[model samples]
Target: NRAVMIGGTTGILGEWGPESEENRYEGAMTARQALAKSKNGATVRIGMTVGVDPVIQLCHAAGIRSPLRPFPATFLGSSEITLAELALAYTIFPNGGWRPNAPHILDRIEEKDGTVVWQSPEDRARQTVIKPETAYEVHSCLVDALESGTGRAARAKFGLKKFPAAGKTGTAYDFTDALFAGYDSSITCAVWAGFDKPQKIYSGAFGSEIALPIWVAVMNAANERYPAKEIAEPKGLQKVEICTRSGLLATDKCYDTVKSSSGESVHKRTTYVELATAAQMPTEPCNVHGEVRTRLVRDLPASGFPRASLAVDPKQVSPITAQGPVLLAENDPYNAVNSTLKPKPPPEKEKPETPSPKSSEETNLPDPTKPVLKAEAVEPDSTKPAPKAEAVETPATKPVLKAERVEPDSTKPVMRAEAVTPTPQKSPKQIRRAEPVHPSDQIPEEDILRPTPPPPSNPDD
Candidate 1:
């Protein structure tokens, strides 16, 4: 069954993000830990690896989009979306792997003394895009999240333990958005707290602190008010103990053994948690490597030391928002947050496959010596869709950028072409396709001057 995983980094990478001078925070964390900690780096890594298109496609299918561009951070609530929309989209996960529109209700059929009416049939379509196991796995990790990690405060404050629960919290950039979303086998609920005029919340505000308590309150009220019957836990599930740090089976030296509600340690018996989520928790140090080390410390913070990354800093999610053209693609923010990109090597003298250009062409185009993107025709269409595959784009259209993306692009030209030969300047209509800059070689004259759409940006050399 197909599944839709949500809540990704909107640009705030914590430990998992590549080290940078500006993005100072780095500490070892697993996916579960990253999510639990609301680590920016971990979320970005997961979203990029899984491919933003899949999750976002699901959100759009479920009708969710914010003013923020479709960058990686959008998955993290960096974008502006209504609380109502957020609630609706998250409900998809618990509806047995259904899309936002899956559980369609029919018109109310009524028969009364004064009113008699026939109703249209309900939309009864049911299919599994994701295995029931996948949903269960995601749910289970979230359940632990409320107990351990950042949500621990929520567990204690809200009295949410009355029922088994699972959910995620979000804090958007500038404290613009705060969200708490969770679901059970039978019921799903989500909530958002933010302002209409974009005022930042109290400096320490976050999903767990600002939003979760509200969710718990509503949930308990729901149990009493609506009184929906609980969904049964899936069968054949047994508790097990394993290292929360390394998803591997626990060793005698396991730093922390994950304990289930049954009080069984992961060491003695296996407890069901999210499958991919095992290595994701920061519960303990790695079995073999110990821990991924950097300047960041595992020691709990002192009073003024800052708690959550989102609350501590808004720039974690979006450091360089583009008020103009293109922002960094959510998945490719490696170049965005870190100012010091891997430096390219000096240009080498000669090469054959690249056509040595005439001096005249060189002058007319951008610098052949500098790095620029050139769109090359595909060797062949390996990306072709299978006949049976559901074709996503209909009446194929050219790949073009929307003139007005939600945010401006944050790209920089760290290296210039080695040769003096001018290459084409990238423009809105003509985007450049970036080619890897080899250590010894400069961009070939032919590659720089190719006829294609220019990139939205072209910083002059």
Candidate 2:
């Protein structure tokens, strides 16, 4: 059976036998240990892996005439079988893969005068059903069970240590049946203890507690006359060392360290169980142990103390997260965190000290003390002949500046402004009475050199 406490799965089938603290899972062990201890989970896992069909085919060849249901639970002996059929199947292991004849008591029958009428066969022939190596391996496992496993009760409880024997114990799911089936070199026996109504025996009524004592008593009395002996080792079989925990080959490091008397460290070796055949042994060493070593760092902390080293399994290290701080490239666009935490500086605003040449505020500002110029509309004489207008005559649009005006052409009537020299000797009253010219009435370039007109005569005079 495979080790169920390790990688084997029970699905939903929980504990099947008795409930006790001693029946709790104690982790993985060798197949021999699992078979000897009658571990239901381990046997179920093995049956599932090996398939129920193969086990059924093997049982049929070994003379087990019972019918088995097509289910994984059949690995735990879910099918029912009579004691004679079970005992007949077990005889194959002792007889080297051959079934023995059925039990018979009568030798012959005489008809009224001591005359032989019907006689049984002098020698009962056996049939070769399975390979000798297969039977030998199974027998070896049962022997180991009796030595230091659940079947140890044979010697402990029944005082049956004189015979060299091998056996297996069986129990139903709800304590309905308890059985003990075993054999020595000469004889084989099977015992069963249970209620006729198929009810629970007790809380912890196991096969060892209920049936093994009776089987031991029968074997003790039977072996005294038969004289028990060991079976010959079958050919095509070899022994190999295997690790108990992993069921693999033992490695050099599969031992614990202990201090010797001279303070030197010594390795206390682990137990190595041998399998029955070379085909049953493992090829790989146990992988549960790992190596540990110290590594050097390039930089130390500012505290001037060595950094504490932590041991990590090499298989579990990730390429992205197992390293120290990472240095990002300058053009890396991906950000690991929010950008709001590290706000960028606002763009610098550019302002020049000198003003531009085309600024209107610099060129249009006028001096307050300068005399203002004014534009006047000139009236042409109605008697004189006027000149023809030029083809490229200037447009009469209003000027935008306060000191400028549109000069008139000779043919078209227009308003013109004439320049006047500032009066050097003007009375205070005339200066106070002078009016300022608006920007809309400024003088044009063509009338800048014209003579100023005389003051208008008041009509009141």
Candidate 3:
């Protein structure tokens, strides 16, 4: 089958645009490789091929309580699932395609008087979801995944290599969640590590790195008591030889010709894999690997032949691109980068230059070169009675004395020369301006003197 292009909103699968380099899985791959490497695009394509309805039905049967809708990312596991549900669901592999009912923590309830009030059922058969052969096939694929694929850390880091087990590692977008679901013949376990609020655990966090270690630790401790065992092969499953390069039945033509040290021609064959179960096993022979042909005879060159040789055309190799998964909310990496790198819009048309206002210090300063003019004071008109004194309280600590100073020009009267006076409202200061001294109002300079210093303190009395 030819590979179909699966594009994501992100730069994954070469979705953003055409370029020499992009994050994508370029060519077709067997279902086994797709599962082993945990490729999202391949998994989605596989789900689509199998039909979305069946996949959703399987999810419901597997105990996923979350609301699910048929969409492209459904198989990619965008929906939320609980740790307990996942652990129970994964038991199908070990239980031979049967979904085990969750066991009771307390099998029986006893009263204080030692009477048993209730007890669990004696016999309950697990619900069969698929055939035993199908489970075995899935188990086999997971076994290889642990052996060499993303779940290899269980063997390499946790020292579970000797234990016979099958498992898969799941990493959520941007490491928001990490999970490891695995099983031996007797026990199935799943481990998850993440915060309630989704956040990146850390840079470069993966399922194998974060969750597999915990699963391995628990499994190791349990195996010490229970002992590790292998899953038994069920009846009706057949074993067949298949080509390793292509997961297809092997043929005699799937061999190459090579010369031995003695110059004798020999047939070099590719490695063969022993696969089981008719549903999972290949039905067609591999066309990729075949016997290589070479000339039966060759002409000998003279001794010490020239080092220079004629150039030969390069062999064509099929192209494939390997890509990693991205967060659903993230924009295409290339597009995001290109958008940032794009030149900024020509600075904003130079704003119409606004005239800056002058500072208060500059505007209020008096001109030094101009002559100062004294204010000319004039007498009040004779006909009008003298204006009464108005006592106004000032808000400040000092009292402000306001007087009407009439200018010489008969136009508008120049009013109110404000004089700062001492507080406590006593002995107000009087400012006398030169008012031409009307003949009838003139007083002797001696009479205008201060009232003689209040007769000195009465020491005689």
Candidate 4:
């Protein structure tokens, strides 16, 4: 015969994701969800935020050896922990955040043969971390978790009588450790399964399988033996049906969900799946950014193009040029400049001559100044550059090596076997100049340069 009375039937697995926003376990799931899943992502976030130090402090306060020994993962059940010490945290939950004495004896005096070494009251005081209700609320979340959540397998496998149960399952990365902790009105106990070498556990097996069934077995046997009173739902909690899909207040439109489970009715309230299928558009996409806003909202125009610029025709036709006519000092576009009518330099000025001062009458004359300027053009520097220089050939030493010779780099570039620093050709002077327009009539430089992208807004910003 088995040593303990088994209460419930053990069942299969339940996943938390594909439903919850954080992918946490449902209706009853709480911090216990972390333990239930052995979730690294969830536990890491919790331990990082809450600090392992505080949990370790609680562990020590609960009369256990330090749990925060190696690293933060120790807070995450990453390090090895004894079953008895693991239950220490649970003791805090039941005792309203106070550490249990776990005290055995006190005030025993000894005779000649049997001696009593000490006689003093054992320390029994509150080691408070949070209010009693806070611990209880967390305890309640765990209890809810056990009822129909990750620990549901235990409840389904064997029904423990008159004793409420709250607990969690733990599995390590690569199935290094599988553990379960369960507690009732009377006692809290824990179980673990792993080889000394931390070998591979059963395929697809977790704490729910390897450890929790044992927890249920042991806790149920203890409950049957002791018969502790069950904990009723606390006064503060109010139950309301929530949509599984939406995670919101249930609505009439939300329909039922069905999942088959071993011919047993597992009634979990879930939302009706919202289905949207794409259809061919009745109209074309807007040209600006290719959105079908008008198709969605009727207030928009039939064609996505914005209403055309108001067709305004001036009373009198004003000739407009792409390069606007220059503005004069009076801000009119008719300004003109004086021109030099001199012919290309005359052939006679190629000869140098004896310099002579001009008469006052000649100096005062504009035409007289023109002829004198032509005489100075005969300087040797005026010789047009040697045409060969235009296609300047670089020597081997000059760093232009044809295919065979290795060459060093020169400041100037070599192209087509010649060193060339080709001077850039200048742009032609503006034939037509611009005249400023009124700001309201101005077409912005930005419009001429580049257009802006449509905004994030439904109707573009």
Backbone collision count in every prediction? Answer: 51, 3, 0, 9
Native-vs-model 4 lDDT? Answer: 0.53
Model 4: number of backbone collisions: 9
Order candidates by TM-score, high to low. 2, 3, 1, 4
lDDT of 2 at 446: 39
Two-way TM-score contest, 1 vs 4, winner:
1
The positional error of residue 98 in candidate 4, measured at the CA in angstroms, is 2.4
lDDT of 2 at 239: 73
Give per-model CA RMSD.
Answer: 36.1, 33.3, 34.7, 30.9
Q: Is 1 or 2 the stronger prediction by TM-score? A: 2
Candidate 3 on 1-461: residue-level lDDT in tens?
11223543343332221111133443555577667776666677778889988998897787677777678666766678777778878888888899866644567889999899988876455778778888888888899889887888787878774779989988776557888899898678989889989997974466888899998888888888777788888896888877665666788777667899999999878545565766667766776676432432365678645576658542332222234543322334333211222234577775885655757855565554554455555676768766767888878989788777453567767675554332322333557787655476355443332322346578895
lDDT (Cα, 0-100) at 99 in candidate 1: 48
Instruction: Residues 1-461, candidate 4: write the lDDT tens digits.
Output: 00111221122111211111123223332244444444444555676788877867766766677435746656556555566677766777766656555543345677788887666766555566555555666676677567766667776765545467788766665556788777877787878898988886854467777888788778867876776665543344444444444344455545443556776555454432211112211123222222223444356567865676646664333333223222222222321221212234456654765555766955554552233222221223334543332345877577653444323355545443433343433434546688966687455443432223446866654
**What TM-score fits each model?**
0.46, 0.54, 0.53, 0.42
Q: For residues 103-141, write the lDDT of model 1, one tens digit per residue.
A: 334556676764648755655555444545555565656
Tell me the whole-model lDDT of each prediction, alpha carbons only: 0.55, 0.68, 0.68, 0.53
- Local error of candidate 3 at residue 22 (angstroms): 14
User: Tens digits of per-residue lDDT for model 2 on 18-38?
Assistant: 122245455666566678777
Runs in model 2 with CA error above 4 Å?
A: 1-21, 101-123, 257-268, 276-461
